[model samples]
Target: MPSLTLADLDQRPELAPAVLALFAAAPPGAHHLVCGLPAAMGQEPTAEILARTSGMLLALSGRQVAGAIGICPYSEDQVTLWGPATAQAAVAEFLFTSTREALHLSRFGSMRALIDTRNREQRAFYRAHGFAAWKDNHLYECVLETRTSTGTVSRGSLAFKVRAATTRDHNAVISILTRAFPDSDHCLPSLAKREADGYRHYVLEEAGTVVAAAAVQDAGRRGWLKLIAVKPELRGRQLSRRLLEGVLASESRRGKRTMALEVLADNAPAIALYEHAGFRRKWTATIMTGPV
Candidate 1:
């Protein structure tokens, strides 16, 4: 193995395009690929995501970029790994270990990597490095065709009433999300930040109370379904499907050509709902985590 030197992306901003190129060439199951991001088809969305990563480290064999990794801090104690992409197999472990050491110097207490299930090499690499399998996540995409309108969709006698969530609905939305995704980090603070970054939350109402809600990230031609949750007691009423349709309708109205989302592989009901809504499974991944 050749000796490698590490460089922080912040100190070497000019190497960004090189890093982007590396990620762009690697597909969902590629050994050098990054995981846990939306849109497996294009580079723009991925680039935008990498641009927001908290820290990135590059492994250099002399002056050439040999490997790289991106870290995104989602919570006070946890960070998500975007990559440990390497140009050669020999430098992979070196890159991953170096990145982990750097993360230990930060406030993060643990790190996670979401790798495509087909990437057995990458999966084994993480496992050998002390990471354990957490959960399986399936990526789904829905392609939209040009349509004048999304007709009045309803279930039974009652019509599903959907609208953009407002400041007044903050508490109600938080309550639902808290119960629906207790382990998720996308709560109040993340919600506010995502909203500020142009992410939209759509809600469904029954009588006067909010029953279901979804968070969407509009990326010009593409949209991402960050989350969708329904009031626990009100589930099984088809409110989830109705709310989903309304969300797709909104994306169609905005002229977005595609929409994507990630759901737990074991979530049969949610998978069935998305499949029924025209979303197709594109990739499956296993989320692995370990102490930093």
Candidate 2:
């Protein structure tokens, strides 16, 4: 390996091209907006943008960028990263840890990562570098053209009234999520945030009480399922599947070509339900936290 040097992106904006070249080789969904594309000789991302954004540092083999690491915001007080995948573990560790310290994450909060679950190499790198797998998220996409609508889908015995979540259902929805995903760092979107983010939610009411809820957001030509939860005590009613079907119907009717959602890979019941509903596995995301 060639001798490598690290530099703050804020100072050496000229290296953006080399860093982006490294990023382009990683799997899809590695970075966004900036896409970390190699900058034209005189066309680097402005210093103002780099300064206001999360801390980012680049790893260079001499003058050519080899690897880079930086924070990408995920939620309030939480962040993630966008960097090269082929770099050595030592280089990754130094850039990531240094960026974390530079941001004073301990005072603000640890930056988080939504890593691809199937990429075992990435997972191992995260583990070796002190990142804990906070959540195991599996991505699934529903092909709208081939699925049954809510009107045609039938349910037996486990009957529940499915309807759009109302403002009054906010408290009940939050309670269900707290019980369903205890201690998990998943992005439990608040009802206010939901509306602000253009998310629509549906709730499953068993005898007029909210037992399960799920939300999906408008993602241009595609639909993005944001959150779903069922009460802890009610386990085998298949309520989640039911609500998902209902949401899918609405999503399809709105002319969405497809819908996507993420669930914990270990949650076999949810996995089975999604699979049965024709939501095939698209990818798996491993939620990783900042270096310790």
Least well predicted 10-residue stretch by lDDT in candidate 2: 33-42
Q: Model 2 over residues 162-188: C-alpha lDDT tens digits?
A: 678888998887777667767643335
RMSD of each: 2.4, 6.7
| Candidate 2 runs further than 4 Å off | 1-22, 28-67, 74-78, 85-94, 105-124, 132-136, 148-160, 184-189, 285-290
Which residue pairs clash within candidate 2? 17-38, 17-39, 79-112, 117-284
Q: Quote each prediction's TM-score.
A: 0.90, 0.69
What is the lDDT of every predicted structure here?
A: 0.78, 0.65
Error of 2 at 99 (Å): 1.5
| Candidate 1: tens digits of C-alpha lDDT, residues 263-283 | 898888899889988999887
Q: Residue 117 deviation, candidate 1, in Å?
A: 1.4
